[model samples]
Target: YHLAREKKGMSLRPPYRQPHHLASAISLIGGGTYPKPGEISLAHRGVLFLDELGEFSRKTLDMLRQPMESGEVTISRVKQTVTYPSSFTLIAATNPCPCGYYGSRERYCTCTPRQVTDYQLKVSGPILDRLDFVLSLKSSGLQEKAASETSAEIRHRIGCVRSLQHERYGSHSLNATVSYQQLERTAGFSEVQLQRIGIVCFEQKWSNRTQVKLLRLARTIADLQGSETMTDSAIQEAIEWRKLPNVLQGGEHLGPT
Candidate 1:
């Protein structure tokens, strides 16, 4: 795909790939007689925005699991094997339900409980677990606009936080990418805070992977606030951001986290 765009100009910026929802597994991931790089590989060091994420086939979506963990995708053909960098930040957007009004404050959800469950589960648990933030946003209807930080200001703040993380880890590693041992050592949570986290994890029945991600997220929240110590408030905020939308189980909302 990129080879076809080479004549345009050499771009120093990282590539961004946003394949359509109907893209097949072989197209989204690479496959050919000579095995070319796909959208994921082309998105290396940049963004892979999967709009209407649930519309994608499960097989194609699950194929991302390995590359997401290993920071690269491997394509093996009859003649040879090839690997391509795929350490891209994935951003996906989808509806709360089939009718897109499951938990809306305005519109009533027309979807049945079963329908909602099935639709939400289109993106599997393992994939959701790999994500750092999972937020449910409401439409900002024609309300009065409020003052907010400018893009440049927000970018500056993010840059500072990133610099801090790089300095702390002695590398380019951010909170989300640091080694678990390194993160735990510098997490800076109080004993009481740790106990609270333990209680929440048990109550939520969160996987070990989720628990690690929660800490990483909390660490980042703390860093963003210019706090050397991870506070209870940071942990709480992280928990809220990490919670999955109300998914039905046995005809009742499990309040998944």
Candidate 2:
């Protein structure tokens, strides 16, 4: 409804919802005797929520890469090729491990190292890299409760930040949604900062795509803070977010972004 209002007169981009039970590349790609359209294609200009993300077949999940990267899904038959829009926000969730207690402090992991590896391996590196944000949630006990901002307060702040982004980009979207060229112009990083990022990328064997993603995330952090400049701290925070999965796998430090 919001998108329709925003894009008046434009074709309605119907949101696609594919349950976890329909976990198959064929299902996603519309494979059958008379193959139809796919979920990714159907989810154009909307959201694709994949619950129990790790349980999805590796091949099925792998099929997401092309559409995610290219923003279109192509289905080829004997006679013709059909293309569909796939510009959608991909949201997913999964357990930390097979036992769902890999990093839990209150509970012990019942799964073996092999089991953990197998589970992690289900979500491929390429797919993981495509994700813009990777957040880890740990259960907080009641004793840890303290005075914190409410959802309304958080939403208000978000609205302010979004307004700032709109003024900056001349659009009602975020830096994350901006193109690489736009990013290069608006979120330009300093030589020193780029050098620092280069050092980490080289050491960690991070791909160029990941490096750009880190910069984009850092830009968003800066925008949220109402900062005209992307400070070193903001860049560091973005880098840390990108490094979180590694930290979960036993890497140390994992300092502030």
lDDT of 1 by residue, 1-257 (tens): 45423334568887778899999887778778868878888787888988888678777889988988889888898899988888888988888677877777677889998987787788888888788877665576478596598889998999999999999989999887889988888778777887887788889887788888889889989998899889778999989877744332211121112
Cα lDDT tens digits for candidate 2, 10-46: 4565585656645678666554545555666556777
lDDT of predicted model 2 = 0.73
Write down the RMSD of all candidates, one decimal each. Answer: 4.0, 5.4
Among all candidates shown, the one with the greatest lDDT: 1
Model 1 scores what on Cα lDDT?
0.78
Model 2 — TM-score against the truth? 0.81
Per-prediction TM-score to the true structure, in the order listed:
0.87, 0.81
